[model samples]
Target: MRVRLASTDDSPAVAEIYAPYVQTTVISFETTPPDAGQMAERIAATMPAHPWLLAEEAGTVLGYAYAHPFASRAAYAWSAETSVYVRPDRHRRGVGRSLYEVLLRLLAAQGYREAFAGVTLPNAASVALHEGMGFAAVGTYRRVGFKHGSWHDVGWWQRGLGGQGAPAAVRTVTDLEPSELARLLALPGERR
Candidate 1:
């Protein structure tokens, strides 16, 4: 597999990949899956501020991962909330890992100090993925969201990104050098 930056044109594939989770599972609380147009808008809005990476092989997108500011407050600028979604058929194939490896590196390079991920309770696959990626258990929000006829808990995980020190201003994805971004996506961890 190979990891690369995600573009607006990849929205249809992204929407397709996320649809199952929305329609059939409580993994995502969204009741209605966004179509290609809405997905494109999401990419356009978030990519300007954070990295959105896609993992593919032989021109087929296997998965994608991305990050956005953890919160709008100034103090939260150095922290990001992250998410990843894979083609259901691509599970256990390292596609999610590849996408995350690139996404985390890009976030750190852009000055993020931490990354956070939230998994719906009882999702062993997602918990395993987050732990395997070096995130530690923080705390769980009990009965946080009501969806699919029940209230579901969400477990949050955290991983430090940049070095310990006062963080400089975070840079947007558009500010990153193309060569640097390309180099990060080529990391060994991003290669299957």
Candidate 2:
């Protein structure tokens, strides 16, 4: 198996892994699954902010992971929210862990100070993955998200990227202008 940054070609496979979760489960709150083109655009737009990764085995995509803005305000620039999904058949084979390991390295390299993982309630595998990746369970909000005809809770987990103090030459993600961000978010290949 191999772990690497995803490209336009990986979207369809990623979407395949994501479809069932979006359609039948509350693992993801998105009600509609994005088409291949839009998923590719999403992957492209995250180039600067995060790294979208795929775990592959013999040319088959087993899982994917990525990070995105935790909040848009300047004060929240150093933080990012992470998302990871694995093909149901590939679960327990370490795909999610590999993807997240790569993601953390990429986020730190991009100068992010903190990373967040929000797991919708009852996702034990996801919660375990985050805890195993050195994330701490900050808390859970009750009834914050409603899906599947029931109230759902969101679990928050956090991890620090760098050492004790903030690094020098800080260029927060919010430092960029709206147009510049739009350009990044609108990049051709990956825009979910």
Candidate 3:
């Protein structure tokens, strides 16, 4: 498996990977699954600023991960909310972890100071994934959302990116040197 920058061309596969969770489980709070067009728009909007990554194996997308603005406030610029979604048929194959490892590194490289993730309650796999990735359980928002005909709690986890001293303005992914970016991204084997 290899991790690479996700493009709008990858949207259909990404959307396909995400739709089942939205349709059948409380793992995602979305009531309706976005189509490929919407997913493409999301990738276009998020990039330059944040990273969207996919893990591909044998020319197929096994999973994806990304980071987005944690809040609307200007003061929240240094923090990011992260998420990962793997194909349901390919869970526990290290695909999600491969995607996240690259996503987090790229976020830090872009000057992000911290990363946060929210897991809907009772998802041992998600909670374990975040904790295994060095995130600490910060707190939980009890009964925060109603989905699947029941109330659900969201547990937030945080990971510090080791940013220190005086702050510098964050750079977009587009601002990085192409060669370096390509080098950092070529992981778990080859680049696509």
Rank ordering of all candidates by lDDT, starting from the highest: 3, 1, 2
Global local distance difference test of model 3: 0.90
Q: What is the C-alpha RMSD of each candidate to the true structure, in Å?
A: 1.8, 7.6, 1.4
Deviation in Å, model 1, residue 81 alpha carbon: 0.4
Report the lDDT tens digits of candidate 3 across residue range 1-192.
Answer: 888899899999999999999999999999999999999999998887988999888999998998899998999999999999998889998887778888888888889999999999999999989999999999999999999889999999999987797668999988999987987687756654
By TM-score, rank the candidates, best first: 3, 1, 2
Candidate 1 residue spans exceeding 4 A from truth: 189-192
Off by over 4 Å in 3: 188-192
lDDT of 1 by residue, 46-144 (tens): 886887788888989888898977899889989999999998888998888877888888888888999999999999988998999999999999999
Q: Which portions of model 2 miss their true places by more than 4 Å?
A: 168-192
Q: What clash count goes with each model?
A: 0, 11, 0
Worst 10 residues of 1 by lDDT: 183-192
lDDT of 2: 0.79
TM-score of model 3 vs. true structure: 0.96
TM-scores, each model vs. reference: 0.95, 0.84, 0.96
**After aligning candidate 2 to the native by TM-score, how far in Å is the CA of 29 from where it should be?**
0.6
Against the reference, the lDDT scores of all candidates come to 0.88, 0.79, 0.90
- Among all candidates shown, the one with the greatest lDDT: 3
User: Model 2 TM-score?
Assistant: 0.84
